[model samples]
Target chain A: MNMEVAHTREEDKDLLKVAGEIDAYTAPELREALVPLTEKEGNLVVVDLENVDYIDSTGLGIFIGALKSAHNYNGDLKIIGLNERVHRLFSITGLDEVIDIGEEREEAK
Target chain B: MGDAYLRLQEQYRKILNQYLENKNEQGLYHAQQFSKKVLENQISPEEVVSLHLSTLEESFPDIPKGAQDSFEFLLEVMIGYGLAYQEHQSLKDRQRELESEIDVAANMQQTFLPSGIPEPEDLDVGVLSVPASKMSGDYYHFVHDENDCLGVAIADIIGKGVPAALCMSMIKYAMDSLPEQRLQPADLLANLNRVVEQNVASNMFITMMYGSYDVRAHTFQYAGAGHEPGFYYSAEADEFEELSAKGIVLGIKRHAEFREYQRVVAPGDFIVLLSDGVTECRTEQGFIEREEITRLIRNHMHLSAQEMVNHVFHELEKLQGFQLRDDFTLMILRREV
Candidate 1:
């Protein structure tokens, strides 16, 4: 998957927009982008998965990794802009409860 | 010429006899060296024929003409050695192609697993999902939210190989699109059931379990959809009880309502979630039962989470006499205050 990060000077929030299929092959690309932001600024990191066309367990693992990394830093990561496809994945896995996810990126935070 | 040819013929006979004695081992080493040095140079094809004919005539002068055709027959036999080398190369090429295909499939399967367990609060969650084939029929996912609520699932799609994996991706998509339902496990599954039934093939169905755990409430609400009844081990009660909520498998029918089961996970209480791969895990001996599983868990209850899981897998291996016939997926959730 392709990833692009947009961080504002608001001092607490980092927005990341990901594109492509976030299955086992492209998950690490997302993980590498998210894990560092968790350490540097700590968890107002909002991941936009709306542009993500496809995802599998590997992508789910990257979300888990980022969530853990943010928690370890005493902050939290939230997911936003999940299309119907991405949203269903979180729901079926019941991940919606584990990581804060929403239809909008702002609401996820 | 006469004396030299006699000496060469005698040398060839001695080497051939030696080669026969060793059957191409120690004697062939000497025979090949002698032939390369002396036989190829001093012995022409016609001269060697004459030498062999003279030797045979001396030994069997009264033999019939049919017996005297042995020299021509030996030349034909020598050409087959080159053909055998070419046949060996053909077999090697086929073997290499098979190995390459297996490598590609294995790499694809590896992409399906979580790199590691996610970090969450007051809970120890560990999962083990392995396939016995290049592609597995098993899959799992875990999600933890800021409110300390966690969602966990383990699924085994029916069938094996690429078809099962393709169905698994569809199942995952359905699960991902599920919306928040105000802590209703049953509704969560019912929604998933509708999504799966729409997308999957007629022959495919998935047995799965989905759970939502609230850390503050310390309660676990979960629903099962045609999966085996896994256990919720109560350290406080000192016993294990089945956590069963059976319904029709997703993708089998639309409007299937999966029942939900709930329990307050006290500090020291946890649940075990599994796919049928664990229960129906077959061996040459027979199928493993819940009693045997409980005994093994009790034996290794004190081990670390991952170690405990490994011990259970080892038991499964023993049952199969050290060969797994199916994918095995297990999830252990332990709550801690």
Candidate 2:
């Protein structure tokens, strides 16, 4: 299915909530939205993939690219609300070790 | 009047013959030089059409009254053809430039592959790699260290062509610069991840399986960074087990960690590693089952390691109608009793 991305600003952090599949075709949209945010200095970019049903290698690549962009600007990028399958995918690829993954906001507090 | 018509027809035929016969650059140069003179003389398109139409009128005084409109329509068509020809020529030139660029990128990508597979004592190794296009996103390297350990790594970039080739090159140099981390699979991948995250573009990442097999210890230690899971075949028990590990792909995070998995190689046991091109092989009915690959490996287990790899490749290629849609890389390591 096509992906839907919603952007919102909470205090100093930028949140991008992504829904639907993030594959070769739809990942570009997410990249376009997140890359600029990552480039901003000291910006905290959190991508919510809670509703994202599937993510392929291409999608993973986009996230990596955004992460690098954030790091370059001394900013930070985090991912939150991954489903079991998506979490397994992140773990399998060992991305769980690198990216900041947060629990649901309420659970964390 | 008839004489005048015949002479005009003769002149037109002569010009056409001249162009067709002298199709070389010299002929074209002369034509271009003549056209420059014509332009200097200020010959308008309407005047040119009128000049031909006047000849037709002179040749046949009794010509149909509607012929002027026909000639004007013909002039418009000719103008359209000229514009189309110019467009086509520019497109051909652009295509040539693109072809040469792809050729250069393909050559550079070739250097990233292992020059030769190292033959470690007590182990047989085989490798088959092919790219679906001019540039491949797949990469494999074998590093044999002084400690009787062989490091095997297979990686696939997310995209293809020059970008992917560049990523593979970065991975190669990164691995080379980290000589101390080669023995430990998890450490090697973690280090490689940092290199990739720091260097590669945000839109690119690599999935890789890195392993080191110590011949004296008979142990294979491995780690995966979102790479395809390989299979371990036990000839003694006649079972195929997967070499699965947890990790995210490289370049995704600065501090990505990969867990290392280890297996003690028993005699008659073989490890098979492959890119997604193998497991994602498409058939008329869609992707073939991963079990089919395991079955192919089991069927060829009796042969030498190289032959076994070849057999599976041959069968898979046949299934794909000899046309692969992605980069394919398969490597096999076997312990001979």
Candidate 3:
């Protein structure tokens, strides 16, 4: 029910490695950890969903909110390491096309 | 209504008079029938108790105080029960009226859907949609324009009931008004998004997949607005690959973009589109995986497109113990040329 976010600073971006289910109840914690990283101008934020097992629509909504916040400051948000289940959520909601679902090196374009 | 109440009172009085006169089996039968009439009219228990006391007074001018005290005790208990019973009856009447309205809306929803499957050349298109409840939260629309184009859309509203039906109506009208060229998958989804975002509430969200089969080109171009990912079966590989596009659910953002996807179909290839009800179908063992659905489709691949679709539904329905938890929709478009 609760998600854990491990923040690791890289060259110019913040990597938020996440674990546990990202559902309605646990999505806010992810939003808090994720949105602030995008608030700073041009900060590239990446969420590693490798450990995530499941995510409901509310979690998808949070990603949308975070994507909006990141874009507002000309910052970029990318998600990588989506397992099959989480990946299916992105594919189902068509978010995979909107958000960058790729590796850390595949940043910006 | 007033006259009916008066007639009911008169009948109750007559039945009581006959019962007090003979206390016979025939009188008892009349009393029982009158009790049923009182219930049918939703007459309160207090009315019956009061009528009984008054009838006793009239029948025996020298009625004893003991009998009178006993009537007062019954009246005291019936007062609370009578009020509750009347309130319950009122609620039942309101519930019945609500159901009637819902039935009308459900019929309207059915009428709005495409009456017959479009018989496009060289394409075997099969569609199946069943609602778990009276009003389906899922909707499918088909548009076969004059330009050798077949457009299909499948949508699922997050919530059900009247609001979902209204949204579906909006989608139906919007699709009807769209020009043929604008019926392309991505364009249609984007246009629908603008319409829904403007008219619908913030909380209301819809997921849709819009696909068009270009008959001459043998291409299926499709797009999604956070709908369930569909599948494409490659004849050469004999494998079912999921088809997906990038987009958010509709009515979320004003300027959300939907990514379009395309697949060129060779002879014997097919595309499968569905709602989450198919992917997330649950049984006593729990949710049957999408892979299981694919297996079922593969097992029934020899049947005609429509039969295959129906076979899968009945199979899923069986696995679900004949109780579908959500609206089930599955569509298949096969290239027969």
Candidate 4:
């Protein structure tokens, strides 16, 4: 299934919301979304993954890329609202420690 | 003598079975000759077994299918053993190559993709690409200057698999060396077409759309090289505008001129660039109407550039049930002006 990307603006921050399967085939959308975040003069960019049903290693790599890009600019790239499956993947891969993954979007802020 | 012949026939069958099972063709041949002699009452089963065992060191030859080894063993076991034989050697050779060919083709297709999108400002460009097979002709990349102006291109070589993939690589490297010529989209296409016509095979051609986004001006100047007409959705009109150029596909004619199409994408306006893969996307009902694609943009025309592109991909997947016969590439440029 093709993944869908949606976002909501809250307090001048772009809360990018993502849903659907993110395999090597569909992961480019995530990368495309994150690349523009760097151009915006925002202090924080929060990615919400609550409805993301599936994610592969390639998808995790995309998150790693966003984290690195955000770090380079001294801005913060944080993840919030991980579903159970995505949370399991992060914990198993130890990405939870490497990234700012939170239980909820509000918690991330 | 007749009884002896019956016993010899049984012994030969056993030897052939062993040779076929164990994949021993030379042994099977030896056993066949010995069985013939036994039927003529010139040798006994014991003599046949002894002859094979003694000569096996020198008699065995290469077994192609491992089918004859058991027949050889059965020949020996019946004289008290047997021998074997193999089938078509060419089939095994082809089977071995099929696996490696797939790997090579996948690597070749991956060569066309950019390792990373170049960093640029003013243009929120996102490329979504998916190859329909192990190898495809779809190619996309972003080139950025120190000034943050980015040149983005998406093209499809007119074929599938290895040959198409090879042509794409050639175009990529040629584009890399033509930075001085990339100032205008038409000049870029002209140079690219000249190079491709000379380098690629006569049967191959490329359909490409190239855009150079002026970050400072918030304008995108692009040229279509016989590719699909891209859509420019004006937030002011709430309708999709066609930005098609009259030009032949690359490699079609040596001096076919390409024309540049320019549009000012204001804040909240979007320019959607795509390969024919999107228009040709077949649904259960039929091929999706170009109008429907534009309507989709109008519906989500308010989202970020990336989000709108992603939603279009999602909608196409839903319409076609996620099966794409051709390469699907889409780039959505939203002006953050």
Candidate topping TM-score = 2
Q: What is the lDDT of residue A72 in candidate 4?
A: 64
- How many Å off is the CA of B57 in candidate 3? 7.1
Q: Which candidate should be chosen as best, given lDDT against the real structure?
A: 3
List runs of model 4 lying over 4 Å from the truth.
A1-109, B1-96
Q: How close is each model in CA RMSD to the real structure?
A: 19.6, 8.4, 7.6, 22.5
Question: For candidate 4, lDDT tens digit of each residue in B1-337?
Answer: 7677566656655665567578777766867686567645655444555444434433455543343555556555665222111123345658779968888878856766877654455556666887777677788878777665678888877655666678788988988888663468888889899999888754356778888888787778888776777788787776687767656667756786777877777776777888867776778785677898888767776676667778888898888888876778888877765
Stretches of candidate 2 exceeding 4 Å from the true structure: A1-26, A33-55, A64-88, A96-109, B1-66, B77-81, B180-182, B321-323
Candidate 2, residues B52-142: lDDT per residue as tens digits? Answer: 6765676567778788779978787667655665677679889999999899878877877888888888899999888878888899999
Per-model TM against the reference = 0.58, 0.73, 0.72, 0.54
lDDT per residue for candidate 1 within A17-42, as digits (tens), equals: 77667754566667777788888644
Worst 10 residues of 4 chain A by lDDT: A89-98
**DockQ, per-model, please?**
0.01, 0.49, 0.27, 0.01
Model 1 spans > 4 angstroms off: A1-109, B1-25, B28-95, B177-184
lDDT of 1 by residue, B88-139 (tens): 6668888899878867876766665566787577877777887867678788
Q: List, residue by residue over B160-220, the lDDT tens digit for candidate 3.
A: 5576778888888877887756466887888889988888764467899999889999998
